[model samples]
Target: MSAPTEPSRTSDAPGRGPDPRAERSRAAALAAARDLLIEQGWSAVTHVAVAARSGVGRTTLYRHWPDASGLVRDVIAERISTAHTPPTGVLRDDLIRELDGLRRLLHDPVSDRGLRAVIERAGVDPVFARLKEALYREGSRVFRTVLDAAKARGELAADLDPDLAVDQLAGPLMYRRLLAGRAVTAEYVERVVDDFLAAHAPT
Candidate 1:
């Protein structure tokens, strides 16, 4: 193996940073890291390797990511945060749309595999775990916005806990993606939406 390369600060290319060049560099590094994770698994990713793969220098990779774990965490956050925002009139419709979006994300050949690896690593890595928590908090915030709209429209049970409902809505998808490694199809998304609606429809 080659000696670990020096650290350099590169612009984020994929909108991960503010500057255009930084954004571009950041995007390039993320894409390279994502590919490595999917192709070689998390264990195979390193700052030097990512730099080499991204056509960036080790210094640049290090400047952006303190370590391999940090790089992976940022990559996951960047990818998940940019997912499509779903909208539907009814609770069921909204949920189905959200779940379907998640399913499509999880089924993506490159991103899915890379995300799975990152999640697995997050289980044992404290820094990654914290990053994961922050990402989920942001995700929940997005979901809560929709739930609040549904509540205003009287589409959800008046007494239902929005947080719990969000959990219920996402729990199955997480289970399938993380543990079962099962396919998240349109049918599956619809089924989950229907089940939640039946159990929590406005009374």
Candidate 2:
């Protein structure tokens, strides 16, 4: 991908405090960028394209997101953040809920492609690679929370590694849906949860 040419910063007036209009413009541009990624693919989310689609000034768009990947990173982050699983105080149920949320997100048309766009580029680009790492940290937060709660309640084996458990639960669903080209059914989710409980349940 070509580097985005730096755009000149433009402002309406010198501001000393928070600017709500700027926030709104940024939100609009991000929405437009996300739509472009889903509808047209990664190449269509450039600063110029986002500005045109969002009706925001190109300078403003570039000022916030210097390139397409920056826009993509924000979009992916926001999308991932929306899938919250309020822990039901049951370890198995919490893990299942989180994985199911992931399955639905992977199945969603918008996330299906928008996430892939950045993921596809992460291997070669350091910037995008960092973005992928950050996204992983975000996606794993729920697992970490649920696992911590379970371990505290003595519901899990004392020696179980929380991080590994997180991967164990989320990995298969993602692999089956994104890589193995298989259907991620509710039954599959339950089986995954059951297996996780079997392996990690307190002795």
lDDT of 1 by residue, 60-150 (tens): 7777677787777665655665354656566667677766766777777655765566577678889667766665676576567777888
How far in Å is the alpha carbon of 170 misplaced in model 2? 0.4
Taking the candidates one at a time, how many backbone clashes does each contain? 16, 0
Instruction: Give each model a TM-score.
Output: 0.75, 0.77
- The global Cα lDDT (0 to 1) of model 1 is 0.71
How far in Å is the alpha carbon of 152 misplaced in model 1? 3.6
lDDT of 2 at 117: 73
Q: For candidate 2, write residues 1-203 as lDDT tens digits.
A: 12222222243345554456876787788789889988987778899888888999987776777666778767766665546758889877888888888888888866777668768888987767876676678778888898888888999888889788888998898888778888899889999999989988899
Residue 74, model 1, lDDT? 61
The Cα error of candidate 1 at residue 49, in Å, is 2.3
The models' CA-based lDDT, in order, is 0.71, 0.77
For model 2, how big is the CA root-mean-square deviation?
4.9
* Candidate 2 clashing pairs, residues 3+ apart or interchain: none
